[model samples]
Target: MRRDILEHYKSTGTYTYAGPYSEYFKSLPDDIRQLGNLICSQVIHRVTLREGNSGANSDLRYGDMTRFPWYRLRCEDDVLMTAAAMTAELFRLDDRGFTFQRATENKIVVT
Candidate 1:
């Protein structure tokens, strides 16, 4: 990862820019989609950096572990991390002069 990108994230509280993660983010259409893409990529990146590999489908703690049903149900931290990332992304957008409001029924997520 580039030092500048890290610094930018630390300072801005968002990867909502879609530049550094162009391969994934640019094609994602919205901040929420981009963030989800970013998080998935980070999981692979972080696991490889720490374990010297992506841990494939074996390690329950990182890598392609999310592919497992039990892993998704049991890994509690993932839920928190995702919520936090979404909040941060939204907050950063608000800070960037975007305003939000309550609306009618909407799909919060897709399965």
Candidate 2:
């Protein structure tokens, strides 16, 4: 899966400009990237759950793994945000039948 994701990123140049966070995500080892992809695959859609009313009746959830510090260490907020943006862009690009080039060596502009 990691190889496939990397191949798609390379082939389509679908990189996201994550500022300093680009290095953090790009430098991740293959195993870690695979793990991240696995987690992301599980969360392709938005999820919400009802909570007993205590002022809050509903809660938005990404994934339970997101609450772990170790997961956060491996996938920082910036990285996750950028990934989400990139995924959205990927869908848009696919709809338009277009592929983009990387704007920089480390990242692709999110916009």
Candidate 3:
């Protein structure tokens, strides 16, 4: 079922959120939805999937989907992103923030 959706996205390079899949995805559990969000983002934004393991077979992108766990993400290159995330955590580099406006006498929101 999901594979058909993926194939459709791959073929058309278009994304739709209001179809039957929207409620279907909303009903899914958190962990699975995490991956689903990633897939949707990649499809809509055309983000390239990282080749995690240098020696991993490229043909085995989604291996053994019938199993409980998918190891595709486990094989991605995590070091650079992990370092950036750690630095962001250390520096509190979040995009959402607020500051006081002296002239308007109000708080300004940043996001």
Give the per-residue lDDT of model 2 (tens digit) for 1-111: 699887876652334455444554455446966756543433323111112222232242232323323321322233546554654444343442112321111121221
- Give the Cα error of residue 39 in candidate 3, in Å: 5.1
Tell me the spans in candidate 3 whose CA falls farther than 4 Å from its real position.
1-14, 32-54, 58-61, 64-111
Off by over 4 Å in 2: 1-8, 11-15, 37-44, 48-111
Span of 10 residues, lowest total lDDT, candidate 1 = 102-111
TM-score of each model, paired residue for residue: 0.20, 0.26, 0.21
* Total colliding residue pairs, candidate 3: 0
Please give the distance, in angstroms, between residue 65's alpha carbon in candidate 1 and its true position after superposition.
12
Top candidate (TM-score): 2
TM accuracy, model 3: 0.21
Locate the minimum summed-lDDT window of 10 residues in model 3: 102-111
- Candidate 1 root-mean-square deviation in Å: 14.9
Predicted structure 1, TM vs. truth? 0.20
How well does candidate 2 match the true structure, expressed as C-alpha RMSD? 14.8
| Order by TM-score, highest first | 2, 3, 1
Instruction: Give per-residue CA lDDT, model 3, range 1-111, as digits (tens).
Output: 699887876452223333333454455446866655433321111022233222242343322122212332332224313323322322242232111111111111111
- Per candidate, the number of residue pairs that clash is 0, 1, 0
Candidate 1 lDDT over 1-111, as tens digits, reads: 999988876553333433333353335446777555544433333333334324453453333333323322322334424444543443343442122221101101111
User: Tell me, what's the RMSD of every candidate?
Assistant: 14.9, 14.8, 18.8
